[model samples]
Target: MPPAPDDRPGPSRNLAVDFCGVSRSYGRVRAVAGLDLRIAEGEVVALLGPNGAGKSTTLDMVLGLTDPDTGTARVLGTTPADAVRHGRVGAVLQTGELLPHVTVGELVELVAALHDRPLGVDDALRTAGIGDLRSRRTTALSGGQVQRVRFAVALVGDPVLLVLDEPTASLDVASRAALWETIRGQAQAGRTILFATHHLEEADTYADRIVLLARGQVVADGPVTELTGATRGRTLRATVPGADLDRLSALPGVRTAEARGEAVVLHCTDSDRALRALLSTGPSARDIEVTGADLTDAFLALTADPPR
Candidate 1:
């Protein structure tokens, strides 16, 4: 989820975010390769990858915090810097030290004041689920609370494009879910959101689209369903007590089979064939369930690289 590298060409007058042949590197390591991507208004997109995958670098370009060595990063059809200056872009970066002395309310209010057109401090706080904590000093809040406060600071600008870099890292399940709810509300109201996350479920459940980055390039791009089904297969789970694991693994259409306690799980290239074979051979295979491959499966299949 570190800094990395997209592309599309020409002026996309109405797109929320545009990256055209964008590439950035540090010394000999290319963080982002030539990449092009376009995000429409009101869409929730996730940039997904592992460490050093260039997710952060790509976001930095979009936020105008770092210049691309080649190509351009645009927000709302303008340079990221211009859009940021006009309060049309807001960002929550992965790492930063919050100001020590200010109260949460004061912090949000200060950011709101910087924008010519800004959301009210109270409104931002409410949207970020931190309205009650507004009076707490920045130094006094827990890590999760502090993160929500940072979200409030970004939301105070009422930006059209919200860019977040690993916004939910290290939070407990409850905190992550809470933050996602606030994000979902913001997106529902027509703001375009682009967030980078290592959590596969976050990308699969929340994003309208997923851009899978590996080593500065996109290994996959599409809807969650499409990516999950990228392997052209289905998964079948069935309860078969005392089943013959070796026989199940040898089923004609099944690519792999494993025992999950009292159940047998099958990854199959042909579901119809596999199902028929299972029911015919394993008469005891009951409580059958069929589902497509999930994002985690697809990610491993697609991003598995050859040994260097």
Candidate 2:
């Protein structure tokens, strides 16, 4: 028999999720390779990686859908399955079939009933921005609306930790913003949020920390600004009519140059020197903008395959 929740030996009470030397495999494929990660309570962490980087496998272990082949994965000071059974962890997965012939409210209510201590079904619907769609049948929902229903189901459990895999997969721009706002509120209320997304901008704007994975291993982990700052140099953009791409690429401090319509973009180690050179050499340059490397730039740099 498994130990009781309080009796389980945990590393810390403040950690919401803990994976120590955790690994999982499928036949010959190593899905997760000795991962060690810890997320504290009230943290909003974004898990980022290219496809086949073991992101889904890592999340699966956290949700107790699969066990690690070696080592341990704990949630809320207990086993993942134990935490989930006690309504302490909730998840919104990328795919799950909703029950047919049920209204949105009915579906949420049904999920709430499964938890030992769940939030009100109406509250969950409102938080997910689907209160107005409560009377609508699950079969009638659009892709984005269906995503919100999944969110409502997760929220209804009132879990201490929330795991979202592609949470905004089918959302429109406005719906995406709205859902993030709700997630922000959840974080402010002290719930730990761990999400995986391909949208770098979402991770940049929302996550307190980012864990980037590649080849079934963590390639980078840090705050958005810290990781992005590690990527050398700035990016310069300007309208330079009839620009010579090769000339810009050859300029001192400019690492690379590309043309976008009438504009020229320069990846620069020294934006001040590059901008001055651009204006002096190409007098047609205008509308200049210099910005530091963003999350996308950092992601590309960190996850890129090594050249042969």
**Best-performing candidate as measured by lDDT:** 2
Each prediction's total of clashing residue pairs, residues at least 3 apart in sequence or on different chains, is: 13, 0
Off by over 4 Å in 2: 1-13, 239-243, 273-287
Instruction: At residue 8, give the lDDT of candidate 2.
Output: 32
Cα lDDT of model 2 by residue, 1-308, tens digit: 11233533245548888899999999999989989888878778899999988988999899999999998998888999999999898899877799998999999999999998899988999988898999999999888888888888988999999999989976899989888998888888888899999999998888888899987788887787778888877999999888889989999889999998888899998998998898889888899999998888899999898797
**Whole-model lDDT, model 2:** 0.88
- What root-mean-square deviation over C-alphas does model 1 reach? 4.6
Clashes of 1: 13
lDDT tens digits, residue span 208-299, model 1: 88999888888888788778778777889999877887888889899888988888899898888999999898788799999887788888
